[model samples]
Target: MSDANWKVAAERDLMSLGGRPRLFESGSGSYVTDDAGREHLDFLGGIAVNSLGHAHPVFVSAVAEQAAKLAHVSNLFASQPQLDLAARLKRLAGTGEDGRVFLANAGSEANETALKLARLHGNPRGKTAILSLAGAFHGRSIGALSITPKAAYQDPFAPLLPDTRTIEPTLDALEHAFAADDVAAIFIEPIQGEAGVRELPDGFLARARELTRRHDALLILDEVQTGSGRTGEWFAFQLPGMLPDGELPDAVTFAKAVGAGFPLGGLITFGRASDLFAPGMHNSTFGGNPLASHVADRVLAHVEDEGLLANVTRRGAQLREAVSALPGVSGTRGAGLLIGIALERPIAADVVAHALDGGLIVNAPAPDTIRIAPAFTVGDPEIEDFIRRFGDALNAASQSSETTA
Candidate 1:
């Protein structure tokens, strides 16, 4: 097995849709070493899922210990870890004492549960239309995909959920959508991750809260990529000016970093929405298994005890400033570790490829935007390394562009 060629083995035994050439053999902190012995700075952080970074001692110990104690128990019977994780998330959400959590396997399932809750909550009021912003990417499941605004991803499965509509993320668009009085719920990402890490304009989210309340519509913040302390806060909606003064979202969805690489996601419902899911309304087999729940709990506890949120804030600003100062970068966007580099030209893909070749991991979510979500445990050294290598990658990309042109 040690001598097995990853590329050849992948091509032979796995699906072709999502294969990467380099086989990561080991990882720690902010770096991963490939089978070929190349150590790469990992800024992608498993697409923002590895909140604490690779092989953190706490994360490893929690999972191992939980697995030994009790890994799975049917939802019919509760586990301590599962219940504790729920309570912890609700507190972090700042929802009222009555707040409730519905656990699922990943972001998609969490959002699917939210959609169901929205439908159930809206049916009695005769409000059925689901509204989404034009640039939102909720998930890939049929229910979540129905609200996702990307036609390229949605068109393949045409004739999606009925009564679904999309509006731009502008005040005017919100006003226009609210005028109809038929919207049941509005799903949005505080920072559009896949659409190039674009932040929802300040005051716009607060205004959405006001409008949704005025219209008796549910405002659901999809914090899948921005939650669990990724944005220098437990949730993006918790950031100042995100919600109306002294107000909270109707519901919020979380995943990715919540489990810190383990498979766990959930929705926290506030106020009356918390009671929308009746008995047997929604459930998951592996949603809140003791192993995943315990791991997530440990991750969250460590996040607080170690003050990773403050670190995220500091590292984010440092990384963004450094990256934005690089050649070919026009600007930077996003908050905390969820940073995006706006390239001066439409060569994000080229930059990403060059960066990978230069032993730095990054991703191009849009033609002109390179996204980076390093681990919460990242330090000045890793950030510095990324900047140096990324600069070289950008130069390489520039050279390639000039040659091609």
Candidate 2:
């Protein structure tokens, strides 16, 4: 079908999330060709999912080979690829020998699994309350959304899973919440991506670890956006000073780049938490199918073999240093390639539109914050292109703002 026709049909049939969507035809490396045949740099990386960028040989080969060999076998059966992927994730997460994995199809499902774990851990002791920070975004599913704490996302789904509370992300607030000794689990994103890439305060995570340990509450880190080396390290919680030297969260949820554009997600439990879920507690038909598992295994292997984590660190620093000097940029936050550019004025949406017009792809997660999450494979050339195009967009936005003022 023609691109215009596709857009028309989408508008007629699809649910309205925002404005009309842009139709993208294909992609290679760090760029995508839109329906209009314009090659635009994909700095957003499908919201940080395309770790190796679009159509990488490793991703293509794994999908094809795995699909040809074997695909689905219900949870009643296990595949080698599934087992291998689970073992790899456990190692990367530093879950040691006791760690267990529950696979799912997306970030929301991964979080739902974690929520179930919380219930299992809390129910026996009559501790049923779940805690989350303000401005957090877990997922749209009812269980995940209950802890998300966003008004617009939660209001319509009134009468959500009760006993879910939103707290300010401060040690005092956290301490007070657990004072009742009825807290089940506390969900946190080491770096809250939907809240404009905001980072938790220094030492907050370590203190959380201490508190959750004292109260016997599960500390679940949502690495759905920051996992699989998007943040330079394998996981954001693994970053320096995120926690005490030998400490780890009770569970961690992962998705996004772990599949490198394919649909796969999971929750990894550490220590005694791994034994929380008994057999028959949860299952997914396509969660750990050979097709998705093999492809995800290959994506992670490619990231490790290619040293893309180092690339993410270096390229992210370069991009931040360059973009911070641009005309309208007030500052930059976030670690590695998951960057949020703060603007001097609330013109991030205007700047994003201008950037798209200039053949760059970015998005505004907030009125004054522009988010850029390019592929982990990004290097000098991509960084240079981003700086040039993004700078032009900033300049254009500045000019438009001045004219309006």
Clashes of each: 0, 0
- TM-score, per-candidate, Cα-based: 0.98, 0.98
Q: Cα lDDT of all candidates, in order? A: 0.91, 0.93
In angstroms, give how far residue 12 of model 2 lies from its true place. 1.8
Candidate 1 local accuracy as lDDT? Answer: 0.91
| Model 2 C-alpha lDDT per residue in residues 1-405, reported as the tens digit of each score | 686799789889989887755788899999999888889999999998999999999999999999899998787899999999999999999999999988899999999999999999999989999999998989999999999988899999888998999999888898899899999999999999999999998899999898898998999999999999999999999999899899999999999999999999999999989999888899898899889999999999888888889999998999999999887789999999999999999999999999999999999999999999999988889999999999999899989989999
Question: Runs in model 1 with CA error above 4 Å?
Answer: 1-5
Clashing pairs in 1: none
lDDT of 1 by residue, 52-109 (tens): 8899999999988998899998788899998899999999999869899988889999
